[model samples]
Target: MPVVRLCEDMKEHPKTSKHKCPVQIISLDDQGGLALANEALSQCLEQGDVGDAPVCLISIIGEQRRGKSFLMTCLLRQLQNQEDKDASWMGSDDEPLEGFEWRSGPETVTKGVWMWGEPLWVQVPQGKVAVFLVDTEGSMDLQRQLETSIKLSVFSILLSSYQIFNILSEFKLVDQDYLEMFITVAEEVGKNFNLYPVQHLDLLIRDWQHTSTYGVEGGQEHLKRVIKDLESLPGNDLVLKVLKAAETQCYLMPHPGTRFTRSNRLGDFEKDFQDCLKDYVTTLVALPAKHVRKDSNGHALTGKQLAMKIRDFFQFLEENHYDFSSPVKMAETLANMREQVNRKIVDIIKGEYSEFVLHQDRDTQTETHCLNISPTEMQKKLEEKCQELLERCRRELLGDEQQKEAMVQDVGQELRQMLEGFMSTYNWRFKEMENAANRTIKDKFKQQYKGYITDQGRENKARLQCCRVQPRKMRQCLEKKGQELLQQCEEELRGAGDRKQAVLRDLEQELTEQMDDFLSNLE
Candidate 1:
């Protein structure tokens, strides 16, 4: 059975589990007059001045059995162990998946405020993450709680393996059946989610999310979309020239001849991402009724079509939190709504890129000149091969590296060890997270307030707003890179990581020796 015990520190090294912070949640009912109650609630939340706590409120909305309860519970688990960076997975054979992987563990956090019918609040890692999961009454029936839902900084629409997009497109399942529910949800998200557009854009470029991104987010067309769409957004136009001139050149990795090379690159997806973002930004900034409606339903797209596709993308962003930020205080998160929009564009590109890699085969047959020569000729080929032949071999090395690169193999092993070490420390943090101020919370609120008030007109990239990072992805990336270099590192680290990286030299000798042995066996 899965371990349901909650611990603050998830990545503990066969060590003590007495550290992690706790998660507190109180559940409330889902039945009530949402319009009236939500209005009063928003006024209270907006004005409460909860001194020590954060003001950001989250509203969880979903159809019945759409894993709403499951997602909420999982989210709470993350919150409970906010300090546990070690909340990682052990090998999947016998041990259970913990934290993100394992839903049921003994680890728990200091519980927070919760309500049943009203709103259940759970903490988030950074900012003031309190999820006000509003449980609906009837299954698959959306309770029109626009006032409360829109007030949230982020909104999520949960789906299970069975659930899909277009709630109204498939069946008319609300009051008056005039898409009143759909329109309300869409407009609220678009408006509040798009607050202070110009200011948010500046923050995005200079503050929360890192500007050094090598993805589509790091390019000229991307910046243009932010400027053009944000400028045209229904609201404000914060930065003009800065947005106009913000340009980027996408590189798969650092320049060629670098120590590390990108395994696979996606150029087309980068362009598509830019195009979609440009179009989306333009639509929102203009806030024009240019969206064509296929049916009488007020949704911009036809029965689950393009015009209304923004809402679906918006929902995805809120759900998975497709935002970016440089923890080093680099980019502005809320300088404009384009930050969120940019993330959507990023997600679309990343998804396509991942597919590009996954769908392609790791193995392929290539035609080669297999000279029908006696053993004598085969020896002559390697012995006589000089500069030109070696260069050709250098080019082939990349393909071999892609297929069977020991550097990647060695790096992968080391990455696992490094990740393990990091996780061990991470789990330790979870145990005593209460001592440290919620860095996540502080960073988030700081960015939000900054994005709200920063000089959007400033063209400098330094004064922008930012996203709140918890070092999760960084650690993961480090681990991945390490894994790729594990084997190479074993030999390199043999001398205590001091020796020059002779990876290509060593691997080539080893391969040549192995091939020579194989060929000689014919004797």
Candidate 2:
């Protein structure tokens, strides 16, 4: 359903010429091509279609201004006509070409990657598989660098299930060297970036002369000899290794001698090439569906996923500055890595900080008495912990120390309020303890005064003659007892104060030493 709606939304307008169609799949800027495949692909995802369907992708690559576009045009036309087996399509002489142009004396007319409006649906053994076509800008463009060309080739190979390597003449040593360069770069890219799959490479030897030696034996032997000699060349064993790993196929075609030179000539050359072209299309369609980049379910990428991946590919190329040769570019990459590490560190510290605060609260809950701590002191502890963590991260992650300091300050401010709330609860508990202690001391003094009065009454009766002396003596005795009671209350208060001070000192020492040890490694 997704693909059906996708096809409907992305269907090409019949009136718009292919060359001028605004919905071109990709376009190039100064840096590289942008994958605009989402224009149609997004609809595919929206409609719940093309789910887990295997897909086969074919891409063409070759030297510039060598009728690559023409070949693509011819190939696409034949492919589209396959659904209508009753009709036969031949190049028109009376009208302008309808698809990709056959431009002559080119200044590299094809700029970036281009794709057919809709993928051709073919029934394979697996199911209905969509065959996607991608046509890239030819290699060795006058305006592009060798690095750019290699990147484009690598990019194309990465995106396709089968890659057509189009060449103007017989395969040469220069071709081997170019492939060796690609192998090296591909290996590196696979290790550092996304790991690209080894796809089937179809070597298309264009403009082959019809000499007797140009037969199957000659072309096959030539390719084998090149591979054999390439093994002896410096650092070419890797190229051979990659070729052996991939499914390499070759096709040799003779030159289309004056096939479309005249306005109305449709000669034997055209007929023969068309027959061969039909066979090529047949072989292409019958080729088993190979999902080079499959999702977890081993299904080919949906339209949306494919579009996004294409975007990421070009972005990857741009970020690397076409190649990782410049020192400035490499430095930028390192900076980006550091920034990523900084973000991860922030996340890790947040978790650690939260867990620590939770444990601190639990520890307070298990204490015998409410801690007599002030809001300012609590705030200082929280800030110190935050700052310690931030400094550690700065030394280890080495990214935006100022920014990290600001973050720590923000976190500290937030936790400052939490600490204040906890301190309020502790203060309330302390107030209750003070009230209880006062009541117990008052009750003890009251009971002791009553006993002293009773004893004094008995003594007064025993010395009745010295009543005046008794009054003064009783007063002195009462005063002494009262003094003793006051001393007892003062001693109890001093013990309470000492207990409070001891608790405070123990807490301060424990936390200070813990924090110091935790931060020592950072220093």
Candidate 3:
């Protein structure tokens, strides 16, 4: 639950005494794996002197081939495009531009370059980091990857469904290997912190780009696909910005435990919250109404007979003849009275309920006010609420599991079928159609014309040559037959020109009439 937010130098985070960087050696297993990893990590951490370099590492953890590389590319390019807006280093005419670093090969350093510089780190204004973006192998083994993943200081889990159904996710979601591993890691994480809806890559930018989707087989197309994914996501301004930023950062590490996240809707620690709500509703219906007026002799009676009788409340009294003046006597009697009648509206009871209700949302405002309560009282009341919430959360989780189990299988099956159909249709044919239809007539014409047309065409050559030879005079040469060869050549050349012009005239006239007829038809 304790997340370490690393700035450029891990300033706010206390440096791990064993190492300069704020690295925690986590050991979720007893196999001495943590110790071994930590030793390696300690060395890695020592070598990593963040310096004043604005760099932070965010690791994407997920099942194999689940769009991790694509997601990373999308983030990187999205950032580059965004950076272009500032009119800075991007697209400068004078300088050779610096393009972002990205590659998809498995052994490629850090699983596709996740930000080569500090552009993304600037988002955390209060913090500074030179991001060393990484995508690890073996997300198939979720537990170990996650334990390793958390070391990145930030991570994200991606799941896709109409509603995130785990079983539906079981097959259609991520690979079985990854799902098992990540879910276990997520559950274990749940034990520590209330997870919020994770920030996943959503890209649909491909829609607007005029480019071919072709690339090396199985190479990254993350930037191209995720842009369109924004449609299904919740439209929260901050969250959307957060996600968009996540894309460029070469990672999305949106934590689930934070407020305003899906975790709020989880209702996990939801104690019988509605009970308290109902009580408040009832109180609003009633008010600070005086109901009981008991005398010093403890022979108290309310005017409303509908309420429980005071004689029944007296049954709580252990000794009938006890000292009335003792504070302890009054306390016992009151306690007994409350337990016995169970219907009396006590002032103390109302006060306790109000306090509990006001602090239900234990956040900034509520927490500040809670300090007013004595530690003991707060603990007792909160414990009661906490227990109720946990119980409710458990019930909800079970109900969700049952409901999900029954329906998710059907949905997952449907989804798998739909995905197959989608792949068949869209991935191949749809893309083919898109590729086919994508060309504009003008574009096709230009492409077709590019090399076909000549600047110094035959007509120009003929025009230049025709200038010195007078057409009428050249025809006259046929009559001079002095050189029989020249005479025949001149005759044929002159006749050919005249015949060609005549034919072209006919074509022009025919074309004009056809165009006129077409216009008339339109009218």
Candidate 4:
């Protein structure tokens, strides 16, 4: 990826250079409907120098006029410095922050999700990753509809790997309520879709009055207190669950100083506020790999993959006509999507199994006779084949390990039942073939023995007539003939046993060949 710096003069650069600025990736139509800036978002995610690289999105969300845009601007500067390995990331303090538009006013400035057009290329142990800075429109504006605020918050959480939940003064009841609702929605969506919805959540308390606790240590203390207090409450289970689910952090920033707030410049900010800000931004960018966006399985996502997921989520909402009016409605939508995914998994397994059976049948048709494998060996091969199918299905399943395992077990049971039926049919056919072969051999031996006995009787009659003159000689001849007939009968019985053994041997060889073919096809 290229190392492109933010323009020094936003006005002149817009006219003279190809350097890009933050662009809105999501917006609201005049009719109050959600509008996705597909082309713009695609440009930022797919067409840039960061193409196909794993991405780490950093987004800031808070109430209106809470310096979210300004903070993103600071983050942009820090990112630039981090990329260049320069200590002068803050640049000239007199230079006004020029990334995302920010000003001290009650009115909202950013209307929707705005993404910096160019990604900061950060090198990590795994090579390089792209980091995108996002500025979301502030939430809880009285002028905006409740649904709008919810939508913005949801989108922010969905798009960012590291989200800064900017708050004024300290964490309050209202913040808790809003956060709970947002986290609930996120959690629901995540559970249904098998996604890691919240990766890192940073509760950034602005203008903290507590002088003793200022940075991370203080922030952590305050968070524990708040959590403990909420734990005593009756209905904060979801909030607690989400907190535990994500990696949480808190930072208390001292007031940026009155002069800096008035001038909207870095030079006038309090030294302590500046120091804290630097620390926060540095820590965020220090280990980009740690914050890389991942799926539920903790596999990092490339830019294009991330873009597709974002688009898919928004498209689902749009198709469902979700108003984002209530968490209940969100839950219902997610449940529906989950069901669809579940059905898709079932269908995939069914299709794969069906194909496998069909292939086996085709191969079976080419065989001249039944492959006589022992029942034990047959059962073992069938079980192995079933397991192979289960593993294939497991890969197609999406969810946490526990959920995936449950689904796999269910599929496995179904496969075993099917194989049981198949085994029954095979065993029945093999038994029928064996019984028929035995009967045919018995009938052939019976006919030959009957003919031999008749011939021996006629020969004995002729010999008796010829030996009538000598009674002793006749008796001796008759005894000898009887002994010869008995020996011949025994030899025939032995030959029949040998023929049965040969048939069994042929069947065993055929079974081995069939099993080898089946296993090779599986591989």
User: Residues 1-523, candidate 4, lDDT per residue (tens digit)?
Assistant: 1111122233321311155578777776554566677766666678755557889999887788888888898888888777555547877778877878888867788887888878888888888988999888745666777677777776787678888899999888888888887787677656754568788899999999876568899898888888888898899997777655549888999899989878877789888888888888778888678998887778888888877766777666655545457777766767676666777887778677666655654543322345445445667877777777787766556555677789888888777777777778766665565556554544454444445445544555577554532434434443454445434434433224665666445443443443344334323
Off by over 4 Å in 2: 1-23, 30-52, 83-97, 189-195, 210-219, 261-272, 291-299, 314-523
Q: List the residue pairs that clash in candidate 4.
A: none
How many clashes (backbone atoms < 3 Å, residues ≥3 apart in a chain or on different chains) does model 1 have? 96
Which stretches of candidate 1 lie above 4 Å from their native place? 1-54, 86-134, 137-139, 142-180, 185-523
Model 1 lDDT, full chain set: 0.28
**Top candidate by lDDT:** 4
Error of 4 at 271 (Å): 0.9
State residue 424's C-alpha deviation in candidate 2, in Å.
36
The deviation in Å at residue 44 for candidate 2 is 8.5
TM-scores, each model vs. reference: 0.20, 0.53, 0.24, 0.75
Worst ten in a row by lDDT for model 1 = 157-166
Angstrom error of the Cα, residue 175, model 1: value is 15
* TM-score order of candidates, top first: 4, 2, 3, 1
Q: Per-residue alpha-carbon lDDT of model 1 for 421-461, expressed as tens digits?
A: 43344334432341122233333333432342223223223
Q: Better model by TM-score, 3 or 4?
A: 4
lDDT by residue (432-453, candidate 3, tens digit) is 3322332232233333222222
